[model samples]
Target: MRVLITGGTGFIGAEVVRQLVAEGGHDITVFHVSGSQRRLADVADRVTLIRGDVGNISHVLDAVKTARPQAIFHLGAILSTASDLDPSAAMHANVNGTFNVLEAARILDVPQVLFASSIGTYGLGMTGPHIDDLTVQRPLSFYGTAKLFGEGAGNFYRHRYGLDFRGIRFPGICGPGVRTPGAAQFHSWVVEECAKGRPYTIEVAPHTRVPIVYVRDAAAGVLALARAPRERLVQFNYLINGVPPTPSAEQLADAVRARVPGARIDFRVDPQRQAFIDRLMKPVDDRFAREEWGWNPAYDTDAMLDDFLAELAAHPQRYPD
Candidate 1:
């Protein structure tokens, strides 16, 4: 099957592209904006690279028409910080861009459309052990609001136009490569800081816990859902949560100390940053996705940390002091 992935050069998108390419027998074309090409240097030859913004409906439609992709993975969107700073841009990227992708899929008659939603949609005042699909979404930020809108839009298209849409509410995704400038950057920053043996500031408080997913597992989950049977997915806009492991600063520091003995980490609570993330930290339940698509995590906190340390060990230059 031929596939088209928007924002295919990003950290998470690149991981998805890597997995799709490795799966073989499927042709992949990545659509990215200017200056994003360098990020795809590793996979440029493996997949076709198209430069354009998803906000432009014509561009997206043209890409789909040109690629003739049976499946479309729309991962292009603005981050929390940028979204908060410039809400109009966020709206254009997250809201308008999503519409463009869905419209393109509708026009091209794409079989499956996978949209990347976030846990942020489940905003503040969520205090519980398990936040399942039934939980109401109370988005707090413009970014979250836009994501919620995207999900709703996709559902509308599915019901009215017979478009197959799947939504994945990703957690704090951690991995090597692009530096994701969002509320979840700390997930990867902690490892990068540890790799460099340098002291870094913690954005959120020590007790603040959020769901996290290894990049590889996140990529796999997207693919699985995209290919799942439509009958199995009764919910068009499904909220699939990745595994969330509570790794406070102390726990993360311990992990770092174990990997790089005497690693320095100064925990200075940033109230503003903490508030934004705290609003989105809720226990996630994924029984629906597990039963419907056999979605399971491949790595736990310990295994993830070990793998991160191993990757850093292999290339020390990337994380400089």
Candidate 2:
């Protein structure tokens, strides 16, 4: 398979790249901004690296033209904190950038385009024990709004142009090297800080619960959705949950402390951030994803934490404190 991945150096994108390389038979090309390729250092020799911004249509066009990939994994976008900080930049990078990718794929006749959407797409006004594929997406944040736009655009392209567009709405993607600021980032930071033998503070309350998927599972879910037969896909995009029972902040802290002995984790809830998290505490229902495309995550909480700590310890250079 000839594959092109945007934002391929990011936390989840990097994992996707590594998995593709390990799976073999993939001619991979990573379309990424400069200076962000640190995560690709290990697999630098295995894939072609193209430096470009997804916000730039010309860059997106050039990358698609150059790779002419069988599949384009569109994972590039400004995240929650950055998007909220500057809506204009997010408009360009997240909104316009998605348009550019879809346009490029349409013009170039790419067979499939996989997208990385988010659970952020569901915001206030959600009424259910858990959010499912059919839930109304009334995204509150700029980043969430942009992703919802991406999902809408993708559906348009798929119906209007017959493009094989598919997406996975991810929950909080937790893993090492997640430096991006967000209400849910503590999912990764608490574990990471403890792995480095440092005391860390959780900005949200101990009882706060946000559904999270380990980064590897996140990457794999996207790939699985991409690989599913078109006849089997009832929806163009699907929501995916990770692990089970949705661990609370206190449970997450306990897990970290258990793995990293003597790990000091404190909670000094920030009312503002807590409010932001409160809007996104709904557990995800990914039954559609599971039924449509074997979307089972390999790691439970213990398995995810064990692998995360092992990765941090084995490759300190990749995930520095």
Candidate 3:
């Protein structure tokens, strides 16, 4: 199976690439923007690297034509903070970029396109105890708006052109290389910073809880969705809570301290930042994901923390603070 992954060099994308290569037999192509294989250091030699911006239709089309992929994993996007900082750029990258990928798949007769959607799609403000597949998609940010639009567009392309479009609405994906600026940064940063013996502060309150998933689980969810029998996939996109029991900022801090013992962590809740963080961090129900495609996340919050710190510990040089 020849595969092409857009934004394959990103944090989650890198894990996706690693998982794909580990499976073996599939020829992989990474279409990235930075042209830097820094995140893909492990599997760089195994996969073909192609430089392209998703916003550039021509570049995407060329990459698609070359890869002629049986499955296209579209993971490229402008994230939350970046989207707020520059919505025009976000629109170009997120909205227009998705369009380009779908269009390329359609024109090139690519059979399947697995999109990376987000929890941002839900318009439901204030994530409460329960959320299911039927939640309304009224996005508050440009990033969420673009993702929701992409989901609809994928649905359209699926029904209209028979493209095997599948997607998962991800929670805060926590792992190494967590550089995207946002309140959510604390989720990954707290663990990495603690593991590196560096002091870090959270702007949100200690009790602010957000849904999260380990990077590996997130990647696996995508792969599982893609590999599921099409006949079993009555869902266009499903919400995937990668880890159970969304930990609060306080819980996260405690976990790090327990693991590292000498880890430094503090909190200074910022109301402004907390506004959107609250929405994005809201709890998510993934029963649909689990039932529809066996989307079982191996890591719960505690397990996720253990592995996250362990990974950082294994590679101290990679996480120097």
Backbone clashes in each candidate structure, one number apiece? 0, 0, 1
lDDT of each: 0.79, 0.90, 0.85
Highest-TM-score candidate:
2
Q: Candidate 2 lDDT, tens digit per residue, 91-190?
A: 9999999999999999999978999898889887788888999998999899999999999999999999999999899889899998889888999999
Displacement of the residue 150 alpha carbon in candidate 2, Å: 0.4
Cα lDDT over the full model 2? 0.90
Instruction: Give lDDT tens digits, candidate 1, residues 95-162.
Output: 99999999988887997789999877777656676677778888888888999998999999998999
lDDT accuracy of residue 138 in candidate 3: 76
* Winner on lDDT (1 vs 3): 3
Off by over 4 Å in 1: 124-129, 242-244, 313-321
TM-score of each: 0.93, 0.98, 0.95
* lDDT tens readout by residue for model 3, 92-126: 99999999999999999999999999888776554
Q: Please, what's the RMSD in Å of model 1?
A: 2.2
Which of the two, 1 or 2, has more TM-score? 2
- The whole-model C-alpha lDDT of candidate 3 against the native structure comes to 0.85
List of clashing residue pairs for candidate 3? 123-138
